[model samples]
Target: MKLPCLSIIVLAHLLLGPLSVNALGATLDSSVTSLHHGSCDINNGETNCTNIIPSPAKLHSGHSSHGMPILNMTDLEPQQRLFWEQYDTTTYWSIANDHKVMLYLHTFSLIISVMALYPISIMLSITKSPFYIPVLTTHLIVMLFSLLAFFIYEPSTPAYLYPNNAYTKMSIILFFVTIVHYVAAIVKSLSEWVIAAGTHDIVFDDDNSDTIHSISSAHDDLDIDNLEPVTGQPFETKYQNQLMANIMANKWVNSTVCSFGYLSTLVFSLFNPLLFIYHVIFVFTGVAWSFRIGMGNQVFNVLAHFIKGGVFFLFGLLTWARFIGAWADKGWAWNLNPNDETQSDEEDIGNDYEGTKIKINKKLTMEFIECFLIFFYGSTNIFMEHMANTNGAWSVKDLQHASIAFMFLGGGLAGLLCESQVVSRFLPNKKHAISFNPFGAFVIFWTGILMSQHEQEIPTSTIIHSQWGNLLATAAVFRLFTYTLLYLKPPTNAEPTRPFTEAIVSFCLIAGGLVFIQSNTETVLGMVYRGIDGMFTLNVTVGATALLMSWQFVVFAIKGWSERS
Candidate 1:
């Protein structure tokens, strides 16, 4: 009796399953058709309705001009929704795995490069070992292998293709640049070694009678009897004597190879292994992930977010580096007066020897650079903003953004003029060391205010914009404070004057830049759909910024320690 009952039930299930599925699919199609009819407009004797029903095989294939799906399960009946949900889940996992693989490969290469280049080279330099050639050779080999791995293990997805892919282009450029850098460095180092070896046997007899007599005869014009008693020694004579002495003491210091080698070493010391690796990885991750956010029809927004944000992010990092004494040798560490008497003398000597007479006012400073970049960005962005409109007519959005660009242009120009000698000559109190130009900061403040109030269709996007905007505004305020403080109590020494407010400014710019990137419409929508909130993104951004800053600090500390040792 039990076996017959089981057989009957099994037979009934087999017979009804297909019929039930077909019935449910028909019901979904009917519901979708009704909804479409209800929602779409009806013209004279004609219907203009979009078909909301999706084919089973192409449930996720429908896309809008913006590259997002036009139809999702929200418009589908229950059974259809279930089918689409399952498909989405599977697709999501596959994509996640692909991303993981790409990231893992990049991480491996980055770690290997960092380990091979950073600490080992620093130690070798400190020990003054002759194994630098081998180390560089090893690095070259590692870079070659890494490039091969990047090519071979890359994902086969269409999104990761080489042609028209910015990430791929940047990666290739970086690889070539790295190769060139290392090759040049190796050649310079080898040249120095050869020169040292060749000159090792040469000796100079400084105390020779003829040499002493020539030196005394050369200094006869500087004798006390030849100078006016009140004036002591003429400034020109003293400067010439010092310049000649320096030239005699360091004959090869101005050699092209030696200068290039010194510059390369300085660059390597500042941009250590960890910082370089992180930057490369960041470029890969940021640009590659940008494709997933869908770049079609939103090129302007994407570029604005990534490029502007990236600049500020880098600016903040450099500011932090300056605070920590990275470029102090060049007098770029934010001192009120970076110029020293000795440094000025050296510059004059170099200028005199090179026979190039440049005016002091023509020299570029950090503030001048800041103004120049702002001006450049604005001038280019004005046209870019206009390009977003395809109808050859300016929209309100275009005009609005263009107005902001105009502000930047005007402010930057004003800043440039203010820092120039033409304007400084008119001021009641003129000083070369301190700059009081506030136009750059004012531009930032105004831009932030506008952005914070900028409206968006989605609340999440608006919140994100406001978040970054507030951060930018805060940074500007802090920067103003920094300027004021510096003006009040000018630094006497040319050291890293780590203003407390600068730390805040750095954090704000970094965090704001990151948040700005996240404010893309598609990105915000995706995060919202995935239940990711603003706080989560903020926390992640802050944490990553902290980690980056800490790594930079460590690199600077190590470099300082090595130099001291």
Candidate 2:
């Protein structure tokens, strides 16, 4: 199925037309001009901007049905001919000429991104290694940068002051984020390479035998029960070896999300209350069951909490039932049968192991189902959502923005909850009361207000572009900062109520949310709702944030591989 390079180039030229014409930019410009200068022909009722009537040998100056004269350039005066030619040229070249700068920058950036990716791809091919952090990281950076550069390099908006250019402006910001990701990836890769060469660790075989021993440490007299390292740090092996659990949990979460996404879209389109209620119940039960799939590392653990919060915030009051069910389950677990405690320790261990194994198989099945759903229902929803707007349905703008805010708010809440879990694990004897962290509270309050806003009419595209667009970028930046603090901070055993870093990060997040809320001055029924104009900002911001957080996996890989080396 693979074509030769020359054939590929030829095909691209044939299909996309040389990539030299700046096709997309030119078409957009042409469409804009067509709105004003376009004329409809009576013969076919077809509209054209620069349509010329065919002349029969001689210059024809006949009056058409609309009383407009159909004349050749030869029949018109020199001044008239000059005006027509000027109009035609402007109509045609404004699109091509205006986008020329952007086209060059866009093409050059593509080359750069592709070049950066080539090395990583080659490395992966040569090593055939399961550890693909470096490769994954390079691809992510290249993707982020390419998308960002495309958005930012618009030739039409040179001044960059247009409020309606929300998509373009947001792209510019995201492009910068890609650069930051690239730098971070480089630093991380080198650190892993260094750490790999410095560590003395053993590798265990499939039969649970420690075959490879560290030359520096004599283990004959060492206490095998002590898992602590010589440096007194908690063994990172606990987290590194939990990749299977992370992968499983990630699959379950993704599947659960895709399921709910499809279900929600279906209900929205059909206006089926029964189906919606069933979807809520399914997500609630699914979320509860999925929580058991994780192996308790912070990455998987945080992800578990995120599913809960995301479901809660996205679905709102519907998930209150799930919360009640979860609480009841917790109570039931606390009051487990006393007779079950009489079982042998071996039996309990065997049961727990078997249960986890079964769940893993089920998660794999769900993962496959999720993939199908993404390509089928996921794609359908995107197309339908666009069609809804194009067909002049009541604007779903407010709902869209609210949904995005709820997602972030949910993640913020999950972050706070994850911190509590971390604290509880480090200090097992102390009962840690959950803090009503400001960031989570602020997000919750705003999300509540947003959820209640009315979506009677579509807000102006201008409003969505100018105000909330900027806020989306700002929010993503702060969220990324929170992730940076969470991942890059030194891992320690300190048992404080909360770290000062967390407080500072919380303040910044709250400030960003406030700025977002306040950015839009318009109020409906005394409540302000921020609306998103173009899908560009939200899509890129979410993607970049997710990818940036994934950098932690690269860090983990470095530690694990270095320890083994």
Point to the candidate with the largest lDDT: 1
- In terms of TM-score, the best-performing candidate is 1
**Per-residue lDDT of candidate 2, residues 1-565 (tens digit):** 0111123222222222111111112211122223332243323422233443311111223211122222232343232232222221111113345445654454344444333343333234233233445464665555565565455444454342222323344445445544544444333333332233242232222234535322232333222223233554334443332432232123333234323544533433332233223333332222222122111121222232233333322222211221222112122111112222132223322223222211101111211221232233323333232221223353355246435444554545444443444553676432111112234334433443443342222232233233333432333344344334433432121122122333333332322232232122111100111112223223333343233223323433443444354
Worst 10 residues of 1 by lDDT: 15-24
Runs of candidate 2 with Cα error greater than 4 angstroms are: 1-102, 111-170, 199-565
TM-score of each: 0.65, 0.25
Residue 165 in candidate 2 has what lDDT? 28
lDDT of 1: 0.54
lDDT of 2 at 110: 42
Model 1 per-residue lDDT at 53 = 43
